[model samples]
Target: MSKTLTFRHVSYLWDEAKALELAGNEVDLFIYRSNLLGADLRLTNYAGGNTSVKIMETDPLTGQPVPVMWVKGSGGDIGTLTKAGCANLYVDRLHALKSRYRGLEFEDEMVELFNHCLFDPKCATPSIDTPLHGLLPYKHIDHLHPDALIAIAASKDGEAIMKEIWGNQMAWIPWQRPGFDLGLKLEQAVQENPNLRGIILGGHGLFTWGETSYESYINTLEVIEQASEYLEQRYGKKSPVFGGARLENTDEQTRKNRAADLMPTLRGLASSYRRMIGHYTDDARVLEYINSNDLDRLAPKGTSCPDHFLRTKIRPLVLDEPEKLAQKSADELKAYLTGKFEAYRADYAAYYERCKHDNSPAMRDPNPVVILWPTVGMFTFAKDKQTARVAAEFYTNAINVMKGAEAVSEYVGLPEQEAFDIEYWLLEEAKLQRMPKPKSLSGKIAYVTGGTGGIGKAICEALLQEGACIVAVDRNLLDETQTDLRKRYGKDNALSAAIDVTDVATINDSLRQATLQFGGVDIIVNCAGLSISKPLAETTQKDWDILQDVLVKGQFLVSQEAVVILRKQGLGGDIVNIASKNGLVAGPNNVAYGTAKAAQLHMSRLLAAELGPEKIRVNTVNPDAVLRGSKIWEGEWAAGRAKAYGISIEELPAHYAKRTLLNEEILAEDIAKAVRVFVDGSLSKSTGNVLNVDGGVAMAFVR
Candidate 1:
């Protein structure tokens, strides 16, 4: 069997690059080939693999030609990589850093070398394996720890078998923890045979190099194809079809909505002690692997590669007494999970003690990244979504590789000692230390009404920017707003609900939807209301009832219902209501609108007093002259305001802007910012107070 690279895409890039200068031209070819390889699960799983190309550029400082390696960066995934994704490192300086490696400690020196040395001073941190590419003499390199190749690399007689299969074409080197020393080992292996096209790391992955991107990429395929063929010919029939993308069959509880129903319960358990997010999937592949009869034995055999232990723990946790898990109550299941997690921690501690070497780093957060429930499915947890998804992909591939290995020969993983060394390696530990602290409301959720436009949309956007999940409430679902929001944050971050604030059933149902999607709502903003302008002489019972129905009665209905759930959740909550300055000051024609807003102002205070014991804080923001784009100011309302002020429609905005002490018109964003200040607890001790977001309007100021 033979494998081939898809060169059509990269060929087009090269044809266009003939006109480009050498310094920045290598990036297009590298990006095209990287994306091509990354799109195939066989070439790269999640963010596990890397690619690089070295080119010569003139140094502006000295007018001398310098070698620059445009290597994949630390946090960039190859699938979506761009020219900005590569870290430009000076190849000569990277090699020179080796001289400092003699006396410095392995872990500390490697971290510092990757951090400080760069050909482009402003480039992001380079991959920890940059030296492996920099010291190599080839112009192009592709390094992917593909599953089929790993299956052979991780076998007991992996080297001998690789030699038998390919003779001198593939050189097998024994496993060493990744660092400055591993780079030296790769360099030696390359020098061992200049004719060699690929180097197989004993417990690591494959490195294939060539003078052009296409040549290097094709070499990877050839090695993988041969390895896949070897396993099939040896024991293809006996293999249990591991490493598939989805499940062949599913139980009742593992199907459709039932699987999604389990996410809130599992996420609540996963984040109980620490605050990690959960991503659940009963994909055919994950379900197939966990539900197999042989999973009990294979689940504890260690991970596919050494670097994997850093994200996924050394192995996944198989639930204790799996037969009794699915039928239990949510509380009972959570308690059982807690007990099982404690046992896992104990086992992890024992493993660490047995494997620690001198200068080994302290243990990291011990929560299992992957958890398997016998009846339901699998769930992966991490602090964010991308890492959780990546962990799931690695485990999915692990299932296939291990099963494929067993079919050929017994599966052999990296020794526990090697796993421990890589897990606590200084280079891997520093990535965590370098991350910036999270935002104040990273895990909180905000439910906002009137979310499509005016002040509602602004509040929704503001909350998402602060790391909180947003549920945008309106009279109907806003698909455009949802699409735009999902594009910015993720699909999980923004949601929409349809409800007339006056309807309790619709309001309660939407609240239930928010709870189901994200665990619970932590903040509430009641901004749904319409403006009614009517003079005392012209006011009808109909106008009065409509204004009161929306501003006062409707506001009460929505807030009280949300507060009921907040009390049950027992988590402290914040409620910010959008009020109007007309509530405090009245004009000749403001009979209906002013009175309804005044009732809302008092209702906020009453709720604050009643719910204070439950730790639910309530406040109000009075926005004046936010008429630039508000629906409230559209037809009859704008005409009425103009009639009261005795001005034409064109002069209405200027009149309001000069009415303020600061003489500036207040925008919807200004009101949104004021609402955000309240929710983030900047005014934690000052609830039941009104914030004047009218650019210093003297008439709206409260004493």
Candidate 2:
């Protein structure tokens, strides 16, 4: 349950500045929210959470201090507080604090942090968490509450639970108050094992740290989610809504046009989750819920969680058109905003009051989360796509929780002051700062069947140029080929394996080895295929099976293995099936090859639809016949084709080239590019597309 809820990308961010801000704020928020979520949900909240940043303050040569740690501040709520909720305390002070005690005794180290402040006035008090954050040597530190911790905390045999869940792999501590003792205990645990990833705070939360903020954040989320999944499987009831979310982008003209502009912005926002982005406006279920009169009489269920308030606002903008419901909803939203923010109506007055405390600009956009137009239900707004998604997810979860919570207590929220504090926190803003850009496929790994073949080699080169690491699998070890590739790039960038794609064991072994070697595979391009030039009468079952084994079965086997890894990674993937133009058009003599190729195309479509929900993209590329390296030259199949058509092979190239509307011979490179397109952003809305890279062959049959 926790695993499903936790977004795998909670840690990594594309924007370095934002990544820094996100890491810091996330760690702080996880720590703050853990208590509210309890050990179970807090563990779900973050497997581990830590924060740190590299900022210049003064030159070291000039004997000046540098800004070291932006640690979590005390008395901040995870559900609300933003970046400013964290404190920027000196690293040296934290280092000293860790040295002073076996465990973190944060209160005892207050004087050290206060004295080490690089810029603050001497009178200002340091954040209560400064010593805690400082105790670790990591650039980022996070304390998470994994679900297993919570379950153990809730259980009568917590010690048994601890041993069962962690065994000897993790350190455990009894629950304690947030600030001093917990920090000290954690510091002591860290000292005991310098290589420790983190310590489980018994009934409290989990602690994790990383060399970088992103790593810390990701580690935290992963640990928590895993524990949550384990606990939920053991003890949790299935949610009333248990199926996977089928979020399709709406076909509204506004949405379609907006998506065009929105995709790039979102891609730039977060490199991880923003990959091949798609979003739904209002899901069918949500629409139904809004239209149902059943909810109209019932009070509006407030937000699911506090973070959602920034996106969806307190409640969904309800729309049930008996008469003029859309207009009524819009008006209601306006009224609600007017009623909610007292100062929104008198912005000028509020502006004047703020000017007295040293002038800064007023809020940029005063409009809150939800907007409902007449006849139109609701629209949630955020600065970017992630926020919008977060809003929608929260709103959905909140609605369910509200249904049950209302039966017991009114849906009260945190104090407005706390909410406001989170809303405008500068540290939170900083946490959103961007990072030095990573290469296009720095973290991406790919598997290429027939990787030693010419076309396969070209595709591998193309993917490699884009920064992807390749796993090249052929029937025999291509060490020389791999050595050349490695020499061109680096040793860690490519792997070569020997495996028969026809055999299930061989295919599985190849996939397992590739995954174990590279951590995981992302793109699987099935270039390992076979062709037989036998007449229909001469085509034997053995021939058909051979073709299928290398083409159809081979592709399926590779795709299956890749899917499992992709699902585990919680990231979508790309699969490309290289089918020949013979598959699309009629083939006279090559019965088995054509049939297998045609089957491969259909298989691609089926897989695309089946894997769409997993975010795994699938597509096929149909290429015209071509010699291995040809300049208007024909292959044996081209000659066979010419003979079948009563034409000379010499005229075949011109005849076939002219047959296509493009009036050109299709090159292997052209087909490879199309394969790249299936995995690239060439067609944003394309999937299950049998892209014809054939030079106008079968012009009437365009797909």
Candidate 3:
């Protein structure tokens, strides 16, 4: 049999001269370009797909008039069609013509370029799909061969596939020609079934329609999305996972909930390694992946899409134990790459050789996109913070689609060569490029009870990098209008409250005000507790009560209140307690601070475990002698620093940095990065974990 459709070519004419006489004005060319881009992405290798829409105009006297149809004009590839490529024609005449020859052959009509038998000289030729659109009652219609959809349709038992996936919500039409024949079949199908949402054209393409342009577009996509989701679930494939709006205008509560889930795991992992994870809390893929059942599943069947290959790899690198897990993941990646692409290692060789052509540029890291651990699931690999985030996004989306495809059957994606080409292609090179990211805590909502101190400011700025919105609480009042911190972050995102962390009533009221002003708090980085770096020998009973009230009791009251609101909202929230590194490893002079921090750490762990069932994740960051810009850093540290390390007070940070393997100074940004990670998705599976942000100072006892 002859093919149902044939390719054709057409180009646009610069008809800007007719701009003055048009009804409803000329459709913007940019929209057409965007549509073309979307279409190409959906159906690059597929054929026999189409798209159309209808436009309306007012009647002179009747005050209501019939609408005109402007389908994707004939004789052009939708892959490259511009606004000028589409034609508008009379809807009534087109419908009348289609009424006859309802099941005719494709060669019935012959019209000149930009001309129609019923169209006036002023009008363009009706699209070949005019009849199809006219036959349907919807105002807009689109058809495309999305790869994710095709993957399922091309599989065995495709009809059974529709029944299982759509659950009889969709109308399945056998393959038919694209002209009058298909139009008539669609009309009959619709009349036979009034409640049909859209038709799975079967081995051809999908067809979705709506009363409005945008609705039609979204509906068309939604059908494919639902189907793709089903398929991924069975075969274990993922689609583009993380491409959320990263604007300042997103829902604060949702972002905060994400941060809450992400922070503890991130801090725990980074503290263990003295390295940072993701940069932002709302870094798209990280948030979605964290929320995915796939990630939470005991045995995840890998990723859902091809683009995820570069970031998440074909499947998540599952790890239960960090040290052994890292090694196992690396080995598995090497083996998979070796087995799938025999001569492809030569590609890596060629790539490195090519890089050698330029001496200034650094060699690219050969690590795959992400490493997934059992408790600390999903770590991305990037040369810098931004690149790592992009890779994470790609991996998350790809994994989602891949998982969705798996539900239909085994997911066999585009060949390994295609994946390799996309990963190494120069077109995708921009993803690896890094630019200075916006503040890490830019849009994050943080509640800091003791905000005026050295530790509080440092924590605030750290939250700033991950784009967090900060709520700075201090017992002392200051002129809010004079500062740039509140002004730059927006008074809405950053709020200053005068309340003591120890006062339960004041904290309760302050939290309500902060939630109302900033929407809700996601990361509660408690830096308000008191600390006395005194020896255990001289510590008084009164000093211990005061410290515990502020550090331990204060945290409990604050976290419990936040959890109530969080549970009602149905999104997982986070709580980050600022515990001393001494809590994890001991310190000689300071007894109360260490004890309180240790208690705080236990509380975080307990809260994380208890809240796990409720989707609330809590954790603590234990920092070692955060003295640089802190008030405590300036005080008696001169004497204690000398006593502890036999060095001057100025040499403590350097002394601390040297204690770690990486030998990097512990910038407040480092701790903040950990906080963002905990709030991102680095430790998605972790809650009751503690992160040591003290330059790996105490590694004697490992978790």
Candidate that scores best on lDDT: 1
Task: Provide C-alpha RMSD values for all models, in order.
Answer: 4.9, 17.2, 18.8
For candidate 2, write residues 1-703 as lDDT tens digits: 0122345423322345544454545444333333333233333332123334434455445678565665444434334334555556556655655455544323444444445653433322344445556665566565533434444443334455556655655677764444555556677877887766666653334666656544555566666555544454542133322122223323455433332222222222222322321123445535433543334433243332334444454333332232432244544633443353334324423533443223223343443344322222334444333344445554543443333222222233333333443444443333333334545555566789888776777777777776677888887548976998889976657778887876777776666655444445678888886566667887789988888888888888878866766664456778888887878777678888888888998899899899888778888887775555532133455555676778887776677788788788876678667766666556646678887877676642655
Ranking of models by lDDT:
1, 3, 2
The TM-score between candidate 2 and the true structure equals 0.40
Candidate 2: segments with Cα more than 4 A from true spot? 1-436, 629-656
Ranking of predictions according to TM-score: 1, 2, 3
Q: Each prediction's TM-score against the native? A: 0.81, 0.40, 0.38
Ranked by lDDT, the better of candidates 1 and 2 is 1
Give the candidate number with the greatest TM-score.
1
Error of 3 at 114 (Å): 23
Tens digit of lDDT per residue, candidate 3, span 1-703? 1111212111122134443334244244323422542444443221124566666655444668657655555444465555665666556665665544523433234222225433334443454455666678766677655656655543445567777767656677764334556676788878888776677664445677766444554465566656655554544233332222222223556444433343333322322222222333344434444444444441234432333444544343333323332454544743443443333234444555553423223434333335443223355533334445545555544443433344454444434443444445442343345335544343345777677666676666556545666767777643452165666643434567777767777876676655444335666777776667677787788878888888898888888876755553444667778777767767677787778878888888888778889777887777665656665565564566567567876677778778876677776656666766777656777777677777666452446
Q: What tens-digit string does per-residue lDDT give for candidate 1 at 447-492?
A: 8888876788888888888777888989754888888898998876
